[model samples]
Target: MRILFSSLVHTGHFFPLLPLAAALRDNGHELLFATGSDNHDTITSLGMTPIEAGIGLDVGAPTAAEQLGVDPDPKAERSPEELVRLIVTAFADVLPRRFVADLEPVLAERAPDLVVWEAGNLGAMIAAKRAGIPSIAHGFGRVGDDDFDVQGAEVIQRTAAEFGVELPGGRGFGDRYLDIYPESLQGKRFLAEEADLRIPLRPVPFSKPGPLPAVAEGERTRPLVYLTMGTAFGSAEVLRTAVAGLSELDVDVLVSAGPSVDAGELTGLGDRVTVESWVPQDQLLPRVDLVVHHGGAGTTLGSLGAGVPQLFLPQGADQFIHAGVVTEAGGGEQLLGEAFGADAVAETARRLLDEPGYRQVAGRIAGEIAEMPSPAEVATRVVKPG
Candidate 1:
């Protein structure tokens, strides 16, 4: 079978699909990745054929934004509710049309047997539907409450109209849904009441291939804490605070300042703290005792996969909800906007490290993740009907 995988340009959106794509490829299925031009190299680097489709906000002109008649100002302050609305309007509604437009030619040319898409990329589902092929909705994290109805409704309606297809009630995108999160971490609201529609796959942690850091080589004398604010939100101030707080403890700290943060800002912390612009979380998580991060779905699931307790300093988006799930599952703790600081972070790190219950719960969740179908198993199953 020829499987075509699609995602948005963002790393967080694109990375989750790789493990399953790899699984299918290893089984001798031909694979092609359809994403923005910016991600072509990343897709090619993973040994998959790349079909450049859609627009990258960072690389291309603001054609999508112009089409939507909205100016996106990253530094501008907006309420969380407003931000969510903006995201829904732009990425969910407007961008899917662009994705469909770009993907139509590929669907005609490639004629793939299956179209596996990241949950948010509604265009792939539309394109596949129009081409009369089955598609799978692969989630990045815990499924959002009402995500199918809320985020996908408009895109489905608009795209179905263009293809002259009738969408049955409650159908949004994809013939089947693939959720990677373990049952314990999947929030109550997002749990699928219908078992057959959703398939559970083990969340395998992956990152850009790289050599492990030297610090990860030796046996650790002290607990190791990994700190990151993710790619988009990392700042020098946050890095400094995290470094200061974690350095005060007996633990060794590995801080990924992200692309936005300057590594020089984290200098002079101490010998215990090693600061780098970035290090693959997959390379570091297994060796770390705990993770401190903005509760992005990828980071949250990655830490959980590694069985490492997390200290969540949630910034926004799904981070807040992921933080709640983490705390409720007894695997970690959360500090919201105002409460998040160096001192509070230090306190939570101490509790997570010293408290045996957190590790125990995290280990349990890890076991649950381990019990889910592996990517290879899922790849074989998905080729058949749901």
Candidate 2:
């Protein structure tokens, strides 16, 4: 069977799905990605073909708000409810609409038998439905308390109606759901919780392959902490503040600034810290004593898979939710609001290192993740050979 994988343009959304794609490829199925034009090389680098599709959320977000006639003054603050409504409108409506348009052509040209979409790429399934193909929704991490499936279903139904497209009327996205989260961290509600076809595939953390970014290049010394804001969030100030806190400890801090941030601009932090635009996270997590990062699903599950404790400085998206879950699960700690600072980070890192409970829980979660079906084992279930 031929499969077309879909995700939001960003690496955080795009990377998690790659392991599964690679797994399917290893099973002798052809696979490709439909995402932003900029991600073409990123996909091709991993030896997969890329077909550009849809705009980024940054472009689709404001447009969704504008369509809703909820334009806000730049100077004004947005209420929590309004912010969520806007997000729902974008992912469930505007972005999906655009994605359907872009994917219609690709679907016709590619004629893929299966469409596997990450949680963020809601429209790909709709496109697949329109093309009379099967589709599956794949999750990246622990789902929050939000009822995205039920609420988003309403918006998706309306979007489908606008296009005069009739869906199979299962869940909002698709009937089949690929659940990558470890069963322990699944929290209260799971994505596609009610779907009969929901299946668990272990969260395999993936990043661009690279050498370890440690500049000192030594066998073993003091503890090493891998620091990052992930691909979508964080700033120079955050990096510097985190590094300052990590500095207080007798640990080495290596920061993966992500592609958006220039490592050269982050000079003068002295020799205690090493900054790289990116690092091989799959390789780095186990080497680190602890992880300090924005709670991205890739990094969160990656750390858990490595049995490494973490200090989450959540910036946005599911980071806050992830922080709460990890803290509750005893696998890590979260820093937010007034509590986020150099002192707080230093103090938290101390607790994470000095305390063994965090590592123990992380190890348990790692064991759970390891026991879950591997991507290769699950790939055959996603799309069977014709």
lDDT of 1 by residue, 283-366 (tens): 788889999998988899989888899998877667777888889989999988778778888888999999999999999988
Winning model by lDDT: 2
For candidate 2, the C-alpha RMSD (Å) to the true structure equals 2.3
User: In TM-score terms, which candidate is top?
Assistant: 2
lDDT of 2 by residue, 115-151 (tens): 8888788788778887887788888776665755456
* Distance from true location, Cα of 238 in model 2, Å: 1.2
Q: What alpha-carbon RMSD in Å does predicted model 1 have with respect to the real structure?
A: 2.4
Candidate 2 residues lying further than 4 Å off, grouped into runs, are 70-76, 147-150, 166-174, 215-218
Measured on C-alpha atoms, candidate 1 has an lDDT of 0.79
Off by over 4 Å in 1: 57-71, 146-156, 169-174
